[model samples]
Target: MFAWFKRKFAKSEAAPAQQERHFMRNRTGARMFAAARQDRLGTAWGGTPLTADEIVDRNQVVLVARSREQSANNDYGRSFLRMCRQNIVGPKGVMLQAQSMTARGKLDNAANQAIEDSWLEWGKRQNCDVTGRRSWRAIQNNCITSAAKDGEFMVRLVFGADGGPWGFALQVLDPQRCPIDLNDQRPRTGAFIRQGIEFNRYGRPLAYYFTTTDESEAGYHWGGKSYVRIPAEEIIHGFLEDMVGQKRGLPWMATALFRMRQLGAMEEAAIIKARTGANQMGFIEWDDGFGPETKEKDDEELTIESEPGEWRVLPSGARVKESNPQYPTGEYAPFYKQALRGMAAGFGVLYNNLASDLEGVNFSSIRQGTLDEREHWKDLQEWLIESLIEPVFEAWLPRALLAGLIKVKGKPLPAERLDQYRVVEWQARRWQWIDPRADVNSAVEAKNNMLTSPGKLIREQGQDPQTVWQESARDVAAMIEAYKSEGIDEATAKELVLLSMGRPQPKVAPTGGNTNEAA
Candidate 1:
């Protein structure tokens, strides 16, 4: 009896543990809830299992995602590009500023200017950047925008004789041409290459696969089995990864895809119904007189163009019912907003910014929402600097040095000393304060208290402090010249400017009569 009881109790006692283990299999249940119960819905995740590779289906994902982005009805895709414009690549893009690392010895001003000017001039040249578009701003925008939409961005350094025979030019490559095949991952070596990107054992990318669009238009190229291998140092790929060792990027729109499709369908339906102007539309049923083949006169003549408030003669025993199928009612806006909120979260944008709706928003809420948006934008800005801007700079600086476009201390700098000459910073999009006076007052206080400096404040405004000082000096000189032209002496005009500028000046007698006259 004891043995039988023990055997029976053993099974029952282990059931809860088995259930717990099953629940833990769910992606969220294990960590979120202690006694979570996950039901099997006969899906691949519940009863069946799928690996990450099996689930992602890389080839299909890229094709379908890019196709959907081109679709006219793809509001989410359009909004993503729009978000990229508003946040990532704004009006004035990420700016490069050179700074000296050493305190005593400042960088050669002329060399810094030459480097900046040469890059700007080169950026405007056709074919200088891979796209053959004549603007660095445009190139930066395209790369970042494409990355957000298409998952990855690729650019190759095109140097040597063919590419202008001077400094390097960049060629933006379409990722479709660079296939991410399984066979590429295998090697007798210590590296793994996937989708044209090669990675070392430590998971750092060592190379990339780059080629022009496949010349063969053969059979639609279903399985991308080929790509040209290129070193990683020659290519700049920009993408955000969720996992630590994610080999590739999942579409930024992936999370919102389902909801976006549903929302689009709903909006289209609403628009169609609204255009129909359907008002209490219903049919009069003939219970007794209607035959299978016969058509009623009233029903035949009754089209959507029928005049309203007209009394109609009906057949015998005709029953009328009104089926006012109301769409886009008071509930519609809130429901739509609720759906968009999720999309905005996925896109890392605020609801108002994503939807451009301010129906019920007040100052405090809008301010807070904008603040949250700024933080997200700032994060992206930092990412852009680290990934795209810095690498490009590192590549460009050496090329510029070799091309003799940049001269450090009036001489050609070696590759080894590039770091010393390459000391620089990039500035991202800046915002004007909500209350300018208040914000300025606070900044002034901060500056006076030594909490911050003028340079910091100027940079926050997206203006270079050195440039501001130089321009101010020029303006003061011009002002002094104008005063001198009006009969004031040179010293008096300079003194006036110095006094107005709040600089210490020697004591001077007051003007006798005219404002310009000095005693």
Candidate 2:
């Protein structure tokens, strides 16, 4: 009886074990999730639980190298880069407007003007860059172009003696200068340096390690190169982050690179085929093996040149077979277009714009495409402003103030008011209308219906509303005064001013008619 009771208890304990194994077997066999199954289809999906940083570390070098090659050699690659810079930065670049206000909440016009003037001065070609070659606009261009090409750009802030008179300057470094494989542990703080960036336990960047020698120099990779440790505050690294906690940027063209290479190969092969077809007219065969006379003629390298509409008489029993290559056939256009469309989608651009193909596109379609792409450009413009422009301005401001480079009323700006002075706006260049007249009419109608304001309209044109109003007021006043000097009545001068400004002329009372009737 005791043995039987012990056996019964052991069987009960084994019951749960059997149930668990059965559950696991069912889960594996059915695969609660199709993607979780281990089959031939799933085998190709090498999905891993690697973090963003690890993925970037594994691919950044090759990605950047291929991206640069595409930009240098591929026509579409060059177009993408050009479009990014032209649309994001524009010829005039981003405009800065000082919005510093006094304690009374009124515009501090003098201080604002002073700051603007000083900033423009510092933006000159000889002042903005450490190399003294790039102006502020040129620096902006380089930053945008580099980001497009390398997926990131680094600017080192120079202060004090190295910063020239303003005590601030920007140094644009090649992203490669910061080695991607430089990883180590900090001896003092026990922090981690991954991809040349030193980070604390919380993953905040502390400093960046830049190689002393660039890749062009001998021994750049394993030549015992020294690294300069620059604090995180002094380095502005601009990149678009697509994943959470991504430490590095991937090239914009990374996904499209393989497609671009294949497209080039296809086009080259097609061209070669066309050229071969054009060059080789036909082939000739002898009736028998080369006779003594034919061999002698071949040995002498005798050849026949045919002109237009010319015919040649062939030897007896000799026939010609024409070569026709049907490569790059009717299917080629559609396939090439589809490939380009995919590439454009990968690059976040319109296929028509990238390929410059306007076929079958009406105004509505083109307008919609332009509008959609412009929104993407605007997003990037804002990113550029936040990532690169704002930081540089804030860093330069305090230094400029301390160095007495920016003055108000002939006195240097007080450093204590830096926070107040930092209140400013960055305006990116706006796109012009495809049809200016139609756009203007729409804006007027919207305004008439109280749907939009003059300020909003002015802003849409990439100008400050207040600035436009002020300029308009000054111009009208000057015009009115000049008319008065010419003996024109003030009422008539005002009417003329309104007329020139494109305003409807005031209604005049009909002769000998009631004013109420005119109204």
Candidate 3:
């Protein structure tokens, strides 16, 4: 039975190793490929295939319309087409143009005018949807006149349905005369030489290709005879949406997870410290009221009163039947009644006296000093953690562990066990001291110990202890200094020190010298 139990435990231990090997062999390759693709495409490349929603989220469509006041050209048309193709479809997508230009002739003037008029009408109809207007003749006229005289024109329109402005289309009118070099290798023609109206099926004035001539020569014309058609289709549905969604969500998720884990760790640490009798001190307001004191009335003084019917004669002159009357002293009057009346008469004098003391004691001014001190301490702590401790551990520990030179026994050492690791003692009149005798030592001693330890018996021959100590110490000091600057507490500093000490050290090179020479 014992043998079976041992075998079961052994199998369980080996499971992770087997799983790791499988993950390295199978998942690594795919993940690497995806990462590379993402880098190339400027998008997320998770191993899993992209979804439609992701594509849509990533898509960014931008429609850039220029008025006729702006110069028009064939390049605009070409750019529009290129933008659409790259964004809407992958590079392999196809593009098609519906041709609508006829050969120019003397009798074709009226026909040309009719075609132009028809195109303009179509533009007007579509303008409401595309340009948010009823008319855009001025803008279209620039492209048309330029196309007619220059024999080419182009404009830009961006599609942001996918991860980018994906889809694009270029409308080249009078293809026979106004052919555009798709490669952009040729010079653009003059604006007056090319003139022809171009539009998206949706009525957006994509561009206008036209050529202008003297009234004697002819106006621009468009017909079946002067144009050729190309047809193509490409699809990258929801690509943009997916890209945007992933880009926005993944980093946020990563950051949130990291922060939550960090906060949880801190909470755990705080709980453990509290259990172990660690006292955390903070300031609390002491409200021992120091305002004015009130006193109660003592005994009332006796008063003698004389009734209307009986008059009291002077004791020495006239004597009647002996009777005593009490006279009131009025000692039970409300406290501060006279003082309040006096104050009301001369309130400005009291105000001036109080104002002198409170001249500089506004709300903001009162708290500024305390706020500044708190901020300074906070900044110091941040510097210590981020600049000092984090860098050294992140940089050094992994290498050490990978080399079989260090080990972490638990996720976080218990607060009670902390003293067993290191002691950071602060003196009233001197700098802090970190004791080296505990489990945690200075970077130098730790490195030297690691180099000469049993794990590197084969690698050790004539290593320099002093050099190792110096290097290690420098590294450790850098980390400690950073933490100190950031305002990390003594306990955290000690933990960081231990963590640093546990990092791996490289084997020292041999040096030729006297046998008794100190490293």
Candidate 4:
């Protein structure tokens, strides 16, 4: 009785395991594997629950093998044995043998057909998604298979406007992960049944796989069938933002200097003068016939003045012939010529002064210690020439000459005809005397040299050169006074002290050879 009870319990225990294994042989095992592969690939699945069509196709096949002893005991066992030998290879003594050859061939054909159809449908879906969204365009012809052990899948992708390619691929062996129901009516029921006849639980199935590249090498590969989580729109937005953030061109200091030079040239030129003089006068003669006095009185006055040996002329006897002493014939001098010359000279001085002042201001502003100081000074110099120097020369020089303030040699030309002289000697001489470069150089050098000397120290210490010279003069005066008081004659005392001080007046060298040689 105890043996029977134990045997019955053992049979019941074996029933569930046997049933689960049979369920795997149908469709559950294959669907589970596909679901696992999908999980590995990371593709998104729609909200719809898992269906049998997504997990296992009706054409899919699974083969099982039976033992030889079981095959010998029943007809069903023999058929099952034959089917296993033709497809699934059974474990045997010293060798393994396929049980169902025809079933294996049919399963192989169905697998190949399923893979091809899936790949075609995937391509169509990808094109529709990329093109419809308008973020991607025309696909390139290059398609490649993955090197992974999972079901091999191929991919074709499109190139961007800048010629970079992007797309997705499926891995046929690994497959994608999917959700499934436990009941028979469910789309893919075999996968859940493989876990046993537990009605309350569901199973995840492995279906189509999506992948870009090997996980370890994904980021290293670009312009391939690798799919990035970021959308193309976000990338383009970032690029445009960066472009808008940049700046262009030179700074305000340089621009302002350039514009000032351009506009000030003409105005500056209208003020420079070459030479100035003040003594030109015009002489005018008047006709006595048109004088206020009558002609008879003018003739009488002429007759009296014509008498010889008489310095004084007698008054005319008749009042009509009387000469009025205060009355005189003359012409008034015009002051316009002198005034014009003075104005021209004033303009020349003004132009020169303005140029000098601007140069000095620029020099003072530039720091000598700075590396760019030389360049800054050069720019300022160019500005001075264009805005101040050249303009003054072109416009003011001519106006000065026209106004008669500028003269040729020492002679002043009339304002109306000042341009007659091709070369104005006096103006040229003045310009040579006031040479801007030589004057500025001499002044700069003198100032620099003066700053380092004992004379400079004395001045800074509050002593004056004029005061020292004056004190020396006073000492000589005192020595003269002492000599005169002591009756030591002034000339002798002066000579004695002058000799003591070694103050002999310098004698001019007679010629070149008379000067002492350094030897």
TM-scores of the models, in the given order?
A: 0.79, 0.88, 0.15, 0.14
Off by over 4 Å in 4: 1-251, 254-368, 407-519
Which residue runs does candidate 3 get wrong by more than 4 Å? 32-61, 64-519
- lDDT (10s digit) by residue, model 3, range 89-171: 22211111112222341223232233223323333323211233323333233233332222222322222221121122112
Full-model lDDT, candidate 1: 0.71
Q: Report the C-alpha lDDT of model 4 over 333-416, residue by residue, as the tens digit.
A: 123223322322322222112122233334423332122322332342243233222322233233434534433344443444
Reference-based TM-score, model 4: 0.14
Best by lDDT: 2
lDDT of 3 at 37: 46
> What's the residue-level lDDT of 422 in candidate 1?
82
Candidate 1 residue lDDT tens string, 1-519? 999999999999999999987777765655475334455542344435554444445443654455355434676668767777667767767877777444458655665566666666666746366445546777778777667766667777777754563457777666555655533554577787655567887778887764444435432344654556777778777878765555665566667777888888888989888766575477666576552336545534334345688876665566666666667788888888899999889888888877878888998898888878888888888988887777877877887776676555677645566777788777787788867788899999999999999999999887777778889989998999999999999999988998999887667866658556643
lDDT of each: 0.71, 0.87, 0.32, 0.31
Q: What CA RMSD would you report for each candidate?
A: 6.9, 4.7, 36.6, 51.6
Q: List, residue by residue over 177-240, the lDDT tens digit for candidate 2.
A: 7888888876688699888899998889999988752335554453245888899999999999
* Clash count in backbone of candidate 2: 0
How does model 1 score by TM-score?
Answer: 0.79
**Candidate 2 segments whose C-alpha is farther than 4 A from its true place:** 1-38, 186-190, 213-219, 223-225, 289-302, 308-310, 448-450, 509-519
Q: Pick the candidate with the highest TM-score.
A: 2
